[model samples]
Target: MPTQGWSELGGRLRAMREAAGVSLNAMAAKTHYSKPYLSQLERGIRAAGSDHVTAYSRALNVAADALSGPSQDPLRVAHEWLVADTPVALHREAGRRVGESLVDELERRVIELRLLDDTIGGGDLIPLVRRELADTAEVVKCGSYTEPVGRRLRIVVGELAQLVGWVASDAGNYLEAERTYLDGVSAAQEAGDSALAGQLLSSLAYQMSDVGNPADAALLAKSAVAGARTASPVVRTLLLERVAWANARSRDREATRRALDAVDDAYEERSPGIAEPHWVYWMSRDEIDVMAGRCLIEMGDPVSAAPLLTAAIDGYDADHAREVALYQTWLAESYARAGELDAARGVIERARSAAADVNSVRLIRRVEAIRRLVS
Candidate 1:
């Protein structure tokens, strides 16, 4: 295998192991390798031979080939397949029309992947989601379809691009994430789904806020809301929340408060009769409260943020390690800011414990920031 291949393979292995909740010591035990040996492999200090790869596969409970195979450059493939071709590729394979069954299967797979993302780090999901994008792109380029079918296929492609962009962002590949999100925006526009295009833009804006581009994030988020005037109440609320976050990150308290108020108004306008997008399925009163609390945290009002965060986190699912750790870290930061050092340290321990089994670089960084604060 190429050196780059081994390095990428090492990252995948480490992700899978951590996602499986296996500690390095435990993995070494299972693989019958020394801790130092496994460490070297995971750090890419030493290339993994086939035997070493097999050991990692067995320890992580993944397919051996998944650990050893050459890594595909999904970003390159995406640009080639999605950007270089016509809106819908003209060249088609004979007798290979896109069908409802294929589309249905693809939709199901997308939902499955989204659900998996809730419980695992992006490192674990990046390769799987990228493969889905690549395969779907192939179908879109080669398979013949009616206009309606083609539109649906393009929507699915756009959804996968959003997911790929999300995982890429979580894995700290910001440039790849931005490029993929733009590709999805194009796909959504081509499908004539303004709501989906808005969603993609909002997702990118959220990422920008996280990566310290709050001005750009705020602009893109507001534009998303303006462009998708017909979006459902929930979708509108989600976009509004991103705007709040961006503004908060920019330290514009007035703008942040206004955006937060807009979120509440949009959410209250939600009607039972209106069909919400599947992507917004996780939105709830508590979710909104959490975002509001997070906004307050960003605006340096931990006193106001603490209670909202506490209540929301109190009812959160503990099994979601990354989310739990992230929320707890924020909560801990609130305590530290409020001069409740003991409380902050206590919460930091809980956050650290929650983060122990996860492999998210973002989560780790956030937790460490809080840890440093408390220490």
Candidate 2:
């Protein structure tokens, strides 16, 4: 196998293990490998033979053939065959698979954006992604695939559009972002994908709130909530939380209370049957608490905000080091608001250390804002 091929496979395996919530020890026990050995395999420090691949596939409950197949080799004959195939039938099938892979790539990129938050620097990747997305959209618009495949393609397009919107918004090009998001909403509607529409609307609302248009944000958030009723329970919970977020930004006491109530209602209704989209995976209870805390701080209730913000900063995923830092900055601001200068200074030091690990303009801007508040 090419080195890059092994590296990509290792990365995918690691991602799968993380997504399934399997600890390294648990994976080792299931695969009958030593913990250190498994770690090496995941890090691509050791080449995995077919037997090891099979064992891992079994442990991960995925197809052994798929995991250990010749396709795993980027320079393998099968890859060449796919690349060189020119027959219409073969070309179509290959294109479909490539499109699917691109969708997965897009999803991964979105996760990176969320975790790193603007720390990656520059907007260079955005246009490349948008071009790929436009290609996918064209394939779907052709409507040559069967209904099931076409539906999947449309969903991918919607997701791509949402990502485009996010990148545009981050780059401070709100008009383009709005157009992209609106396009996504329309595509979702065409595919009867109400959940995706709600997600796009919620993202747009978040952008609006960040740019100081709380009233418009709240309106968009309400529309998201209305559309979310047709989504799965987990989606509804996230959308409701977003509604709370918008209301909190608007500083509308009654609206905020009602939005929080709605969040509770949705959370209470959540069940195992409710399938969550990949984008909403990080919206945990801790994140919701942070949103509430931010809202309270904006409403001039520092007494109520401090503890919640503290918990939020503490509960943030450590692997998302940049986000943890951003939350810490917010926590410091909350402490300063409550006249706890020593505590605020301590948190600021932590934030500064974390910021060093990730060079994000957005995080830097947030730190500047907190400094202005405390000083």
Candidate 3:
């Protein structure tokens, strides 16, 4: 049921259609909407999302924002689609053919936003990323795309959701993080991309590990490892590393050792020069070394952790402030254990300073832990 605002917006839409000198049937033909549906939409009996506006604008040779005119109240105009009444029994729209250029543009923007996450931290980029996700989700729902193209679009949406969840976690918004992670998992499954789904699950496992029971965390990691069995060896290796980390946190030394050994085997099995998941593009010897060191530290094996931590810190990019800060904590702890107070203090200071540039609660907590050691 369209309310007063929706009716006003509908009136504007009708005016636009009429000014274009197009019949309802012609508009329906151009926009790929049924004539009856267009009539209902124009008569304020139906509400439309952003994708509908985009399609209609394309048909009328007008801009999308221009189609959503200011005839409605500010709040209604801003979130008109959100106010749409959802049916109790859901029905998914069938996939149709969206333009490749449109998909390509979204893909490019996604990658750029991901890179921004790497340098800027999640706190600053969460709102922008969240808004982008909403916009892209509308495209996935309403744009006409073939089954194959629709699959690709779903993957894009999944990737966006994953990024949003990652950012949310970093910013300490645990609830939002979990919700987006679950949403991404559904999206990945819908796209029939098990590898992506497993990756997202692994991320969720890690997030849960922060505050949940070690057993629960370990189970989540194990599930991810099982689900990604057919994925690339690198992907499997990464997930296995998480398993080791979780087990170590639980103080299951035997389980941690087994997981670590499995990760080693997976790494050795990987073939060189093959393409990897874009999400894991940053994984390398340095990342593995860091995870291994982290697990060792968690298991109270600072003696064994020291060398690995040092190597990882040396090889890590200085520009990655959040990671540098985090890795430095374990490295500092190792030094403190070895009675190298001066060296530990020095590294901890550097880490703390680096962490200041980021807004991650996790890294900030690590920073505080190391500061106590320095004192």
The CA lDDT of each predicted structure is 0.79, 0.67, 0.76
- What TM-score goes with each of the models? 0.74, 0.69, 0.72
Over the stretch 188-257, how does candidate 1's per-residue lDDT look in tens digits?
Answer: 9999988999999999999999885899999999999999999999999999999999999899999999
Arranged by lDDT with the best first, the candidates are: 1, 3, 2
lDDT of 2 by residue, 12-59 (tens): 677777877899999888976778876766786544443455567778
Over 1-375, each residue of candidate 3 has an lDDT whose tens digit, in order, gives 111244456677889999989998898889777787778778865544344566788898997667776332322322442344211111123244466656765665565556456555667667767877877787777777778878888888888898999899988898998899889899899999888898888888888777677889899999988887788988898899889988988999999989988888888876533435657656677788888888887777888889998988886655466777888888998888778899899989988888877767878887897888779
Worst 10 residues of 2 by lDDT: 70-79
Q: Which residue pairs come into collision in candidate 2?
A: 119-360
lDDT of 3: 0.76
Tell me how many clashing residue pairs each candidate has. Answer: 0, 1, 4
**What ranking emerges by TM-score with the best candidate at the front?**
1, 3, 2
TM-score for candidate 3, please give it: 0.72
Kindly give the stretch of ten consecutive residues in candidate 1 with the minimal lDDT sum: 85-94
Q: What's the lDDT for candidate 1?
A: 0.79
Error (Å) of candidate 3 at residue 136 is 1.3
Q: Candidate 1 — which residues are off by over 4 angstroms?
A: 1-95
lDDT of 2 at 369: 79
